[model samples]
Target chain A: MDFSGLINDFGPLTVSGLAQGAIIALFALGYTLVYGVLRLINFAHSEVFLMGTYACLFVWGLFGLDQNSAAPSVGLMLLYLVIGLVGAIIASGATALAVELVAYRPLRRRNAPPLAFLITAIGASLFISELTGVLTHRNQKGVPPVIQAKPLFTIGDTTVTNLQLLIIVLALVMMFLLDRFINGSRLGRGIRAVAQNPDSAALMGVNKSRVIGLVFLLGGLMAGVAAVMYNLKIGVTRYDAGFLLGIDAFAAAVLGGIGNLRGALLGGLLLGVLQAYAAGLFGSQWLHAASFVLLVVILLFRPTGLLGESLGRARA
Target chain B: MSVSEKATFRSSGGVRGWFGRQPVWVRGVVVAVALVLAFLLPYAGDIPLLGPQIVTEGIDWPSALFNMSYYVLLALGLNVVVGYAGLLDLGYVGFFAVGAYGTALLTSPDSVLYADTGWKWLMAVPVALALTMVAGLILGWPTLRLRGDYLAIVTLGFAEIIRIFATSTTTLRGDRGFASIPHPPGEWGGKPIFGVTDAVPYFWLGLVVIILVILGVRNLDRSRVGRSWLAIREDEEAAEIMGVRTIKYKLWAFAIGAFIGGLGGVLFAGEQGFINSQTFVLQFSILVLAGVVMGGSGNMAGAILGGALISYIPDRLRGISLGDTDLYEYRFALFGAVIIIIMVLRPQGLIPSRRRAMELKDREKEVAPQ
Candidate 1:
């Protein structure tokens, strides 16, 4: 229906989509990593991301930076960004650990049925989100203008903004670091072992509990970064913001092969771009519906996903 | 007998055992009496202890009971899928929406398909039920083969799609919804019995539907189909290897569950006389699910109690206050905390199925190695 409009705005839409996709890729790593090792969906992980978004806002608020404030100078902006990122990372990591300890560990010890774990995860998720909702009066909090979206470059009809470049570059750097950490590090081997087979990993003298905790922490850190980038781009955060985005990120993880790291990256980018295109074609109201249709279709046709669930395989 | 066996025997030796020992005629009479008492529950506000405790302060007592009826219906239907069949359907509300929408389209004057006079509520019921069952098959056919979590996400996606479609489509009228969805046809001495002012008739109607659903579900739980569901839930691969047609039973579970859930929706629309996309939020599905899990997922009595409590607690909290804030404001948060606590303390739920309880005990035994 809007072919000509889509063609006209193709460059700009794709650029924006890529920026969103980069953030989604970062957000998706949390789901992929946890699902890889625990084989649980970690429903509370959305609340973990949500906590990061609010934590960063709280930190920025401490520095007297309200939504109406002007962007700071280069040095101060960098300092503020660092402070926000640290606050978010710490908050998200602690929340993830707490969720695991409170909602999951007891069930694990009890050897509770899989349904129990899912239900508890949902409970934990609801508890945090509803608590936040009550505290915030369900209002959307606006982010301070820390870094203004100045055009850094222009190509065709697209003008790449500084914020978008920062988000994309930062996400890539984090992904590269995570990839190396999992592939080249000793701890990464323990993660792979546990993912392949938890019992075998425990038999091989791996501290299964420690590894699981570490996995959660790492995922939380990634979600934290994604949270900050999301604030910078979207400029507002709400208590239930994570609910919809979390679905998209989870779909991305499953789309790329749920247990595979690299696959998450691929899936997130593809999904983001596809969503942008779909929005262009079908109007913005059908944006989420389009993504869901794609998810169902892919699951039906290729349940193993594009990368074939490599985290549980020997190669990963 | 082993220690666990003694405990199980003791647990089953109380009211349930007494009821089991009665003759079939005695059981039938007891059920009839209970049903009669339930029909009189609209006047429960006149009672001393039961009325003051259970009746909602903000909303009328009949309305709350009506709410409980539909919620109980949803829980029982969900119990079939999640409890008996071991399928985690996060999108059970989708069927409810379908049923309501189906009825709305057939009966509401605002609907494009409506004729000179729209269909009666009774006429729309069977169509709504059939549509929901078909919807279930559509959703389940491709996704049931997935692992549990995957199936969950897919079902979640399915509901989200339904909601998004409802919200975005102009034909469904989005949030404006359809109005004048005809109430169930009835007259009592020159007055409409199912009028908007009194929700008691709706409650009775819901009660009747629930009884029918209970009888149907109970029979299914005793048949070969129910046995296959049990086998699948306990172990899918073993059941498949044992020559149980796992897929067929799972689909059957889904279809039946959808039928019951759709029945809830049809009754809901008829009572409300209006419906919109807002009525079918994902949270509604989750609330029903929480009710089932908390009540006793695999037990009919448990599902009924759980469903009633979930609706009742929120309504009961209405107009009550804690210190500075209204208790209703914190109801969902409190419910969430309660869910976490219950799962931690009693993962088998408040009134677990006997077999499920035994299974949990067996699993604990393996873990503890006493």
Candidate 2:
């Protein structure tokens, strides 16, 4: 509809898309890791990310920082960042564990049908979000501008912001580290074994319960990091933010190959860029619609996703 | 019979056993009495303890009952897809929206296509249902081949897409939706029977529609299609191997479910005489789902009870205060906790279908350590 607008904004759109995709990629890893092992959608995982967002804000609040505060010195900013990250990681990890213990574990113990698990997941998700909604009075909390978005570089009328660079770099570093852990570590091997065949993994003394807990913790930790980066980029967090973003993250996971780690990264970036391009072509309101359309198209053609589900498969 | 089975049979011999042993005529009489009582519910405020306790204090009793009627309609429809067919459709609201929008497009003066003169609400009903059924089929055709979770997400996406379109499109009228939509038509003694202000007629109309739906759904449940749905739900691969047409039955479930959901929407549009994108939210679908799963997924009675309760509870909470705040604010949060507890304690739901209950018990046996 607006080819010229799209062409003119292509560079800027791609840069922003990559940054947004980086955050989505991290958020998606939580979904991918859990699905690999449990084959459950973990509908409450969004709430886990939401808890981290609030926790980081709470930490920053302790330093008397608000959205309007002047940027702190680099040394103090680094300390605050470290503290906020730790707070967010712990909060998210704890929430993930709590969700599993409360909503999922009892059902698993009962050998409840798969539908029951989904219902409970939804229940847990609603409970956490609604509680947060009540606590926050359903207000959108502004993130303290801990990392201001100064233009770091310019190319073809597209100025890449420092915030964007940080988000992309941090996301890649996290993904690389996660990939290594899954591919190289002893605990990661346990996860892969369980994912491939739960019964066999149990027989081989993989400690299925511990492995599942570890997976949730790792996913929650990644979501926490993503939450921080999202704060930096988006500058605001709301109770309902997770619901929409969760869909995007989940879409990315499925598009890239749900259980596949690297696929989430690819899927996230692709989806982000596509959404950006769609917004340019059709106006911003159509961005989400475009993503959903893209998701449906991909699922119809390649149900297994672009990379195909390979989390359970042995590392080559 | 096995020892545990004998014990269960002995335990079930109280109220249910008494009911089971009743003559067919006697059972029919009891059901007839229950139906009469349900119809008389709008007048419940005249009764002693039951009246004040059940009727919502915030809104008028008839209006609350009308809301309950539509909610029940949605639950019944969703139960067909989720409870009977075992299809997790997280976007059931999409069908409901389609039906409402269809009615609006045909009948509302505000509609771009129908600005000259709008059709009657009665005339729009069938068109709306047909549109919804078609929407259901369109969504089901491509996504039904995928696994259960995949179907769930796709359906969710479908609803979101509908909401977006409703919000963004000029034709649909977006947030400034179609207004002055005609109400359902009927007149008595120089006055419109289905006029604004009084909601009792709407409640009665909803009740009539619900009864018709229940009768139809019950008959379907006893037919080959219903049996096929059961077979598909219990084990799709096994059912396919046994010569059941899985895809056809699933599509039937989706379309029928859509039809029922659409009916609710038509009635909703007729009652409010307004249409908007805000009316159909993802949470609306989820609430109906919770109703189905919480009440008893595979049981019609359970779906009805769950649906009614989901509608009734928030309305009941509307006037109640907790400290400085209204209890209605915390209703969803409390409902979420309730869902978790119910699933944990009774995953089969409160009024689970007998066959489904038996199947679950058998599964529990199989899962128990050797």
The most accurate candidate by TM-score is 2
- Runs in model 2 with CA error above 4 Å? B1-17, B368-370
TM-score of chain A of each: 0.98, 0.98
Best by lDDT: 2
Query: Candidates' lDDT values, in order?
Result: 0.89, 0.90
lDDT of 1 by residue, A255-283 (tens): 88888899889988888888898889889
Model 2 CAPRI quality = medium
Fill in the DockQ of model 2.
0.64
Every model's TM-score: 0.95, 0.96
Cα lDDT tens digits, model 1, B59-80, are 8889999999999999999999
Q: What digit string (tens of lDDT, one per residue) describes model 2 on residues B168-192?
A: 9989989999899999999999999
- lDDT for A316 in candidate 1 is 47
